[model samples]
Target: MMNICIKTVLLIFLSQIPVCFSYAEFKTDCSVPQSLNTKMILFSVDEEYSLYSPEVIGLIEFHFKEKSFINNVIQSQYVFPGNYDYQVIDKDLAIISIKEVVGNLVSKYQILLVCISDIQGYFIYSLEHGERMPNVHRDTGLYILR
Candidate 1:
């Protein structure tokens, strides 16, 4: 009876959460390497200042001979809106910061990259800072690391 009750409660809790799908395609022919030279890309879907919140996407890439590390962002309850930027603070770490203007409000969001090796060859993380943003950000917990 206890086992059945636990399973029923687990099913009920999970049922309330939304499902999200992710689609990724790799077009590169490069082979996986033990180490990489790292590069990052951060951008918003739009620059328009309106009542709406735009989507922010971050990409961290690791290349052959490039060494990189990662760190976690300081936990904040305040959500920031805007663009993203980064600086390599150490041989294996980089800090990414966000600042943008939406209407009269200047918003900010940030993340730190600390190191971990995944099977995919590099570490990637994404954060969607708004309630109405795409479900993919929330479902994936915005992090993909190799």
Candidate 2:
């Protein structure tokens, strides 16, 4: 009798697990990497102010169940509204470095890069214009060493 009761209880517990989550399938819309130096930023529109910037951060590795891969968190940064920074002319890029992380073993990702593009957005407030001005946007690439 005890054995029958235990089995019945265990069966009930296992069955309840499915009702906990109704979703049957899990899917991700992000694209996977196909080649070197050619990664499509997940959401270009949403990547303006990412902390990773272009150069300072590269070789970004994501920790999956057992493996990891590189990814770009910040596609662009260092821009002013009225005066956008153009790389061809300015020759400066933002480089992102990962100082540290609390959980290194779990996600072991350390970012270290320097922006080679000219410092465009590093500006002081203008006395004549209180409103934020426009800065040019230039295509910048992150450099990661092997």
In candidate 2, clashing pairs total 30
lDDT of 1 by residue, 1-146 (tens): 45555556656667853233222222233332223335322221222333332332233222112332232222322333334455665444455554546566543444454433322223233333433444223111123333
Q: Write one digit per residue (lDDT tens) for candidate 2, span 6-116.
A: 556766677753223222233222222222132222212212343233223322222211122334344343211111111121122222211122233111122222322
Best by lDDT: 1
Where does candidate 2 stray beyond 4 Å? Answer: 1-11, 19-30, 40-146
Candidate 1 stretches with Cα past 4 Å from truth are 1-81, 118-142
Model 2 TM-score (2 dp): 0.18
Question: For each candidate, what is the lDDT?
Answer: 0.36, 0.26
The 10-residue segment of model 2 with minimum total lDDT is 80-89
On TM-score, the candidate that comes out on top is 1
lDDT of 1 at 94: 50
